[model samples]
Target: MKRIAVLGMPNTGKSTFFNRFTGATASVGNWAGMTVDLMMATLKIGEVTADVIDLPGIYDLRGFSEDEMVVQRFLESTPLHLIIIILNTVQIDRQLSLALQIKRLQIPAILLLNMADEAPKFGVKVNAEKIAQHLEMPVISMSAKYGNQYGKGYDAAIDAIAQTLHQQEHPICVRNISDCAIDDRQLATELDAILQDAVHISTQHSNTLTTRLDRFLLHPILGLPLFFAAMYLMFQVVYTLGTPLQAFLSFGLDWIKVAALEPVFTPFPSFLKGFLIGGLYDGIGTVVAFIPVILLFFFCMAIVEDSGYLARSAFLMDAFMERLGLDGRSFVMSLMGFGCNVPAIMGTRVMRSPGLRMLSMLVIPFSLCSARLNVFIFMTTALFTPQVAPGVLFSLYLFSFAAALVTALLFKGQFPNHDPLVLELPPYRFPTIKQIFVRAWVEVKHFLRWSNQFIIAGVVIIWLLNHLPMDVPPASKQTLSGMIGQAVQPLLQPLGINSQLAIALIFGFVAKEVVLGGLAVIYGASNDAGLGGAIAHQIDWVQAYSFMLFTLLYIPCLSTIAVLKRESKSAKFATLAVVWSIALAWITSFLFYQGARLLGF
Candidate 1:
């Protein structure tokens, strides 16, 4: 297998091309730094197997950022037979500077003029064959989005690489290296000549509705309001559209418990039946049934991303982000982190400044991810009636943003020289439905897989914690949970949470969702109640609201911290996230509880 490396400036569709070539969708977006980790896929090009490594997006090779170092190390250490340099055809001069640097390494490389379709619309064109003749390597002009246009050309490029591999000679040709120095005059003259000989200009209608909308969307005053409105609508859909589906799943699960499990377990003892019905049916089944809501959220996010509105969001927030000690680009990663923190942390590679990347990684975990959304919904819907739940949900999301902002400011104060945000805006295109579905399916599959493990294990643990006394008489309020809750009750009393809810908050340190699972088990033992009745009858709404606040501000999950350690390479930073999050959660919950009490809640 030959190793093929994909390199490009940020947002030049390197990942889009990589996905097309390797049949792997590793999150392509108009925004930069979409692929942070090394994504490798084996593809059969004709009869030969090709291993493709999609590296992080970068502008210049000379940088101290971790992502640039990752790319540099890969190039220096790996035995790459071919480098497919993806360049934006519209920005030829800037793109070719990096191409020239790669050629200096004397490696066989193919210059892929990606986004060829946009060149003419941008009043530029390139003659690929002429450029190839000058550079002494194959040049391919193709749209990665429309693969059929360059399917044969891609194969031919690979065939050319395979044919030349046996001949132990570098294919790069450099004449008068001094002339290609890319200084002011020389670079301009060469670009002019190159454009004169091998390019064409055509006036084409490039009417973009996205650009027109951006006039309002990118307006400083209007942009934030619009963003909040759009986000509010998104959340509303997650609840409004998702409610029927959630209800359907609940009804189905209830039917299975009564119609299926009860009949099958008729001969079993009552405890065994309760274990099967309560633990499996009500516990794991409820978690799994929320797959539709998760998928719906993913699908909506994918559409917004593919339509290129997400980039505008970043552009819109640049000024506000600057004040918070984060670049506008950090918002993109944080937004992705809301879907899942793993990829969001990984997405930090697009930030060129090391300080900003680390800061973004530190704060991104505070973004409430979709995994925590189910817990939020369960808790909020149970505590507040449906009429008041939306406000509670909005407050939780706002708290996440506030926590992240404060964390970023703290880091910025510590490291004062972080680089400011600079990004290229790509022309917006309507995302293909197939692409949206594929990405959504990938996320849904991942969530289901995690739910199967963590949720199941959590439910079982809660069950064991509640039931291990082996049919002893039901414990009173003075039992284990009660004792622990009472011990911590003073610490959380200012937050309006009672001893039982306080105990669940302590258990939430294990997993955010476990807070709900713990409550279900505790209340289940008390009155044979499920999650619904547990929250409705036992926990006060004030306590429930305070619990949500704590959950929002509390330490990130173990996996999130692990990613932070790996990404930041600083145990101190990870520890800071945990400590500060806990402190903030306590402080916030305290204020909420005391304030609510004052307001006579």
Candidate 2:
């Protein structure tokens, strides 16, 4: 199969195009490096089958960020059959520098003018045929988010590649230079000529809603408040408005237990019934109960992203970021970390400075990702009533931001100097309803795919741990996990997390959700009603609060650690993040416990 690599600067809709062509929802965002790692998919254009690889979004090849290095290595080793350089029509001048470098390789390529629809609205027009004549290659104008108008253009590029692969001479070269050396000024002049011929200004409008909103959203005084309010509403909706949906799902699960399982298992022994219904069903059911909240959270994020608010959020955070020895552009990755940290860490390549990039990667783990939020809400609402749950949940998010800020400050003191933040502010437009639904469904599907395998395995593991005994009664403080918990209890005693909870926290290092899984095993096995009922009967509100605090601040899951190791390129940094996070978690949990006790809570 022919190999075609899709290259572009960040936020140019490369991922959206990849998703459209491959039918793969590889996390499309309004920010750069969303596809941090290389993504491959097969696209069949009539008689030709081609392999399309999506490379990391980069600004210039001259820089040496991790994502840029990935692209560099691919260029050096792989014999790319064709290169599709996607350009945002609004930012054509800036994006063409990379195109100039790609052309120097003497490889067949096509200039894909993505987001063509937005160009006209931004008072810019590009003549595709004129651009093709100037560049001496095909130039296709396309809106990848909407249609297949450029299908023929993509085919033409492939045919050009096939025809030129073995040719003795190529059309592209540093023109009028026999020495085979190109100068920066000459490259700029050539680019300006191309833009002059291909690009035209139609008309410009003033006082757009985007500009008026930015006046407040980007203002130093009002920006932070608006940001907090926006996030507050997002969390509140997930918890408050999603409650009925969550409860309805839980009610249905309960009905299945009573109406379907009860009658069929009437003759079974009580232990067997408890094993299947209470241990198995209750353990998995609790985690599943939060699906509605998860979906709602993704839906809300999609709206914010689609509405083009995230870019403005990044712009607002840039100034504050400079104080921390990193650029504000890092906030884009940190914000994306809310949905998933893997891509967010990868997105750090957009920072341009290696020092700032590493610093951003270090703190990304501190972001309260959606996965951890699941554990947070489940434990918080179960321990405290729903009326006070939003406040408690909000506090956890605040704590996470605080942790990130403190870490950034500490890192800043150590490093001392870094690059200033430079970012592009794209013109905002109202996102289509169809686009929002598509993005939401894609995220929901991604969540289900990951949760189904790992969480199911987690449920079964907890069942074994809870069921297996070492000559100790189920309710005895001398049971297997209890003994293990006691052995480590002293270390966490200062933090007010008891032996059992500490043991659960240790298991959580493997995966944050496993803390709840561990709790299910310990509490579910002891009581017939399951983990929720057992916790309600045994643990007081203060201990529950301590548990939530520890869960929020403790070590991230193994997957996040692996991504950190890869992004930071130093085992020491990754280990430091893990150790410091745990220590911080212990300190915070301890303070909350003692303070709550002193306040007579």
Candidate 3:
């Protein structure tokens, strides 16, 4: 099959165009390095089928950013039939520079003026045919988000492109950069001539809404407060709305267990029945019940992202972040870390400087991800009253920021970086209902896909460790997990973590999403209520808080560590991520628990 690459600068709707044409659910986010790596999908246009590769967004071919290097390496090494170079129409003046650079490669290419619908609103008009005549290539003006369904405008565009492809005889040949080099002044002169001949602009109504909104949203004094208020409201909605949904889901799963599965297993042996229902059903089901909460959180996050406020949040935090030897982009990665640390770690590829990316990897794992949030909600509901539960949950988030801040400061000396933050503030647009729902659903599916195996395997292992040696009481000190937890209890005692909880922490190393399931298995609880009751009976509120703190700061999951190792390309760096975090976790929790006890809490 012929290969085509979709390439562009950030926020140019390149990925959206790729998704609409190829039907791949590549993550659509409004930030730099969102693509991070190449995403491949198969597409059929007219009578031809081809492989579509979505390359990471980059500003210039010669730029030194990780994403730029990725694009450069791919273009130089891979033979291709065509390159679809997308440019944001509103920013075409500068964006054309990238196209000019690519043209020097002397490869077959198409130029897409993406976000065309928004261009007129910004007082911009482009003559695509005229540009095509000038550049000797096909130029298409399109809003990638529209005509999403099959056999629509986007599909027709692809059909036309395919027809063009059939006219060519051979795969594209790679060209050396040194041979294509042109003087900067000559390139600028050529770009100016093209803009003068093929583009028109009116200044009156350009970006009016964006400028007006930025005044208030990016204000020095009010911007930070507004950002915080928005986040606080987001979490409040996630919890207040998610709690009932979680309870209903828990109830439904329990009903399925007792009403459906219990009868089917009745004829089986007693031990087999107990193993399936208790070890498998209850443990995994408890984690599954938290799905609604996770979905709601992502739903809210999707809105923040699609509405174009995510970039603004990064802008507002940039000044403060710089004081800590980081910048706004790093702050944005930390925010993405709140959703999941593995992808956020991968996102550090957006940074141009290697040291900044390394520093970000070191700090982003400290984010209070939704997986850890599941543990917090479970414990907070069980230990704190409804009136104060949200406060307890919010405190964990604050702790996350504090932890990231300290990590950045302590490690800044090790990884020195001096890159300035450069970010685009896209015009605010109201996201469609379909966009929000699809984004949330995709993320939910992602969480399920990534976590299911870990959750299931961890649950089974914990169950076996607790239930083996049938002569001893289940979860008793005589069992495997019990003896292991006991062996580690002395070390954890200072932080008020007990043997059973210690076992949960050990398994949590596999994945934070498994921690709740591990606890369900360890405590022999059949449901959320039972698990809550069992935990409450075993530990006081103070101990529970200490455990939460430790869980918040400790080592990242196995997936995160692997990504860290791969991204940093160093085993030592990944090992440091593990050791440094656990040390920080121990010191912080010990201080908090001991200090609270001294203050008579």
Top of the candidates by TM-score: 3
The stretch of ten residues in a row with the least summed lDDT in candidate 3 is: 27-36
Q: What is the lDDT of candidate 1?
A: 0.72
TM-score of 3: 0.94
Q: Which ten residues in a row have the lowest lDDT in candidate 1?
A: 27-36
Runs off by more than 4 Å, candidate 1: 25-36, 149-196, 200-211, 261-277, 385-387, 449-453, 471-486, 498-504, 513-530
Model 3 lDDT tens row, 1-601: 8878788998887867786677655543322333244567776766777777888889888758888877876777677888899899988987998888888887888998877878878889899899888788888887776653422446546765787778765787565565678568978988998999999887675787888899999999999999888898888888899888999999999899889999999999977887898888988899889999999999999889878899999999998888888999998889998889988998888898888999999999999988898999999988999778888888888899999999999989899889998888889987667667767777788788888969989998989998778788788889888899899998899999999999999999999988898888887632345788989988888999999999999999998998899899999999999999999999999998999999998
lDDT of 2 by residue, 442-510 (tens): 777766665555666665665555555745566356665666777888878866677657656776776
In terms of lDDT, model 3 sits at 0.85
- lDDT ranking, high to low: 3, 2, 1
Give the C-alpha lDDT of model 2. Answer: 0.73
Please say which candidate is ahead in TM-score: 1 or 3: 3
lDDT of each: 0.72, 0.73, 0.85
Top-lDDT candidate index? 3
- TM-scores of all models? 0.85, 0.88, 0.94
Order the numbered candidates by TM-score, best leading.
3, 2, 1
